[model samples]
Target: MRMSELSRRSGVSVPTIKYYLREGLLPAGRQLSATQAEYDENHLRRLRLIRALIGVRGLSVSTTREVLGALAEDTADTHRLLGLTLGAIQVAGETEPDSPEPAEVDALIEKLGWNVHGSAPARATLAETLASLRTLGSPLDWRVLLPYARLAEQTAVLDLDQLEGIEDPLEVAERALLLTVLLEPALMALRRMAQENESARRHADGTAD
Candidate 1:
């Protein structure tokens, strides 16, 4: 496809496509002339992935570039590929990088037998959230999280199920990114609705908090 066709198919303007090419977010097309190039399905897929990562997920251009770079490195292991793509996503809570690692967090992970990396962003997020709770005078027991962790484990299965049979690395990454980020609000809404239902069921009135 020509640049114009690529632009038409991608829903991106011609100038913006050129800008992506220059920024290294989108790969260069095959040279057709001194001033023209031809693109293909791979480019289209990658272009869409770039748009999702930047536009929908709100990743900066530099971060998007790093993600694209990670995608370029050939990896036969699907797990590693998924990890690379997932690492691009920054989970909401980020405390100081130099903050002390909480031992309770490690103990909780051990209790759950979760094979999470020490450097995982969610680890820091959990630690920070737990710390904040203590600072706010509602210190929670690490054991209290066990039930939620079990539920999260089940939920994680459902989350990974969304990626099944997605062969394209970019497509897998894009789907995972959208599902993980977009579903957060939906999950919160579900929790609120469930709480109301459960309250009414148990208390015979929704007014009982």
Candidate 2:
């Protein structure tokens, strides 16, 4: 297909597609003539994957590049690549204007017995979140996150189980991308439903009191 057809099919603008081609996110099309090029199904699939990574996953260009590289590797370890991608998107907490100092973060890492690599963005994110929690007068403790972490681990296992026996690498990668993009909202809604049921049970018990 020509550029205009590709633009219509992929729902990506021509200039944006050109930018992606230039940035090496999307591969260059075949030169059919002096001023015309042609794209194929592979290009269409790649463009959609790039859109999902950037638009739905909210990954920065550099991070998305790293992820795409992993996906492209013949011997790439999917689990490890997913871990790194998730780490990049992890929300440590929130930050306040008068947030705690980096030194305080160092101290907290020590206090929590966390053996993090020396001074990284992850550490900074944690520090900022802790500071924000404090500013909001919320109880901030490592123990509080334990249950949530356990649930997250279980969910990861569930996601992997769902993906088991996918021999096709491209299909596996696409499924993984879609799962990550869609699962959070699904989990959140499930939690809300559970909360409502529990609240109803509590109200019934209170009425009996």
TM-score per model over all chains: 0.89, 0.66
Q: Mind giving the per-residue lDDT tens digits that candidate 2 earns over 48-125?
A: 878877888887888777777766764267665555545556555545556554556666556555556663556768
* Residue 208 C-alpha lDDT in model 1: 56
Model 1: which ten-residue window has the lowest total lDDT? 92-101
List runs of model 1 lying over 4 Å from the truth.
Answer: 91-101, 204-209
How many clashes does each candidate structure show, in the order listed? 0, 0
TM-score for candidate 1? 0.89
Which ten-residue region of model 2 has the weakest summed lDDT?
Answer: 80-89
